[model samples]
Target: MASHLDLEEQEQLEQVKAFWKQWGNLITWLITAVLLAYAGWQGWNYYQRQEAAKAAAMYDALDQAVQAADADKAASVFNDLRERYAGTVYAAQGALQAAKVQQDKGQADKAMASLTWAADNASDDSYRDIARLRLAGLQIDAKQYDAAAKSLDAIKSADFAALASDRRGDLLLLQNKPAEARAEFQKALAAMDKTLDYRRLIEAKLATLGVAVPADDAASGAAK
Candidate 1:
């Protein structure tokens, strides 16, 4: 009976070895793959953090240049930032800041170029919309009426609809299309948030056009 038990144990050991032989290589390879993937993920996250840190430092330099009101320096730093860190939010913000400095320095062409870059390359939708809005205003100031209209038309976000309408009103008024301007202002007033101080400005615009908000509509808007 002892010899029989020894034989049974030997048979069980052999079955275990056979199972390992069939599956051991596959299990080892799967574990290696998982480890490699985890290491790659960690490396990617580290790279992103390093990139953001570098971008933040460059953005700080751009900010200092802006504070000094050195338009040329700001533009130079902004160009560097855009070239190296265009994928970062800092680059988009730098474009906006540089554009403002350029505009204040009477560099209309440079300002427009910066704004156009932000509008075309910003990762965030709101930033793009803001760039387009400011660019439209600058185009208007330049008396590039057609270009201003094109910029306004490119604004796609509903959040900016009222502002875009207001700008369109300005454009139409400049073109001596008062009737069209009034319609656009009315659209702006209708879309604008009633609680905003800017809404009152739109109302004043309508007033200048010899149009008044109907009493009932005014009351309804106030109630809202």
Candidate 2:
């Protein structure tokens, strides 16, 4: 009976060995892959948090510089943000603020550069749209009328369609094309929300161009 028990135990051990030979490597590899993937995911999350924290600190510095009227320091910090954290929303916001500062200081070229960077490199669509609109405004100020028209035309966001049309009218008016401006203003009026005070401003613009906004439309706009 003892001999039989020993044989049974030995058989069980051999069977276990055979199973390991057949599938052990696969099982080990699967566990290893899972562990590595989990580690990588954890590492990625950590890296993103670090990046966000760094970006936030830099943006704070940039904001302080802007508030202090230190254009050089603001530009330096913004350039750092552009180079180091361009993928962050903070960088885009910094660019917008930097552009405003430059514009206030009459540094049109610098403002254009900052706005161009935001328009080209911002990760968010809305930020890019805002940058493009501001860039178009700067282009209009620079007497780059054709470029402003093209810039306004290239805005693809449906949310900004009315504003783009209004900007296009501004470009046309600057070009002394009142008829085209009036038409664009009408399109803007059509696209804008009736309840927006901005719509009334557009109507006033049309009036200034000697185009009467229909009384019915005005009443509808007012009622809303």
Per-model RMSD to reference: 2.6, 2.2
TM-score, prediction 2 = 0.90
lDDT over C-alpha atoms for residue 220 of model 2: 78
**Candidate 2 global lDDT:** 0.92
TM-score of each: 0.88, 0.90
Residue-wise C-alpha lDDT for candidate 2, range 1-224, written one tens digit per residue: 99999999999999999999999999999999999999999999999999999999999999998998787888999999989999999999999999988888899999999999998889998888889899999999999988777778778998999999999999999888999999999999999888777888999999998888888889878886
* Residue 2 lDDT, candidate 1, scale 0-100: 100
> For residue 171, what is the lDDT in candidate 1?
99
- Distance from true location, Cα of 62 in model 1, Å: 1.1
lDDT of each: 0.93, 0.92
Q: Kindly list the per-residue Cα lDDT of model 1 for residues 97-209, writing each as its tens digit.
A: 99999999999999999999999999888889999999999999999999999999999999999999999999999999999999999999888887666777787789999
Colliding residue pairs in candidate 1? none
- Please report how far candidate 2 places residue 87 from its true position, in Å: 0.6
Error of 2 at 173 (Å): 1.8
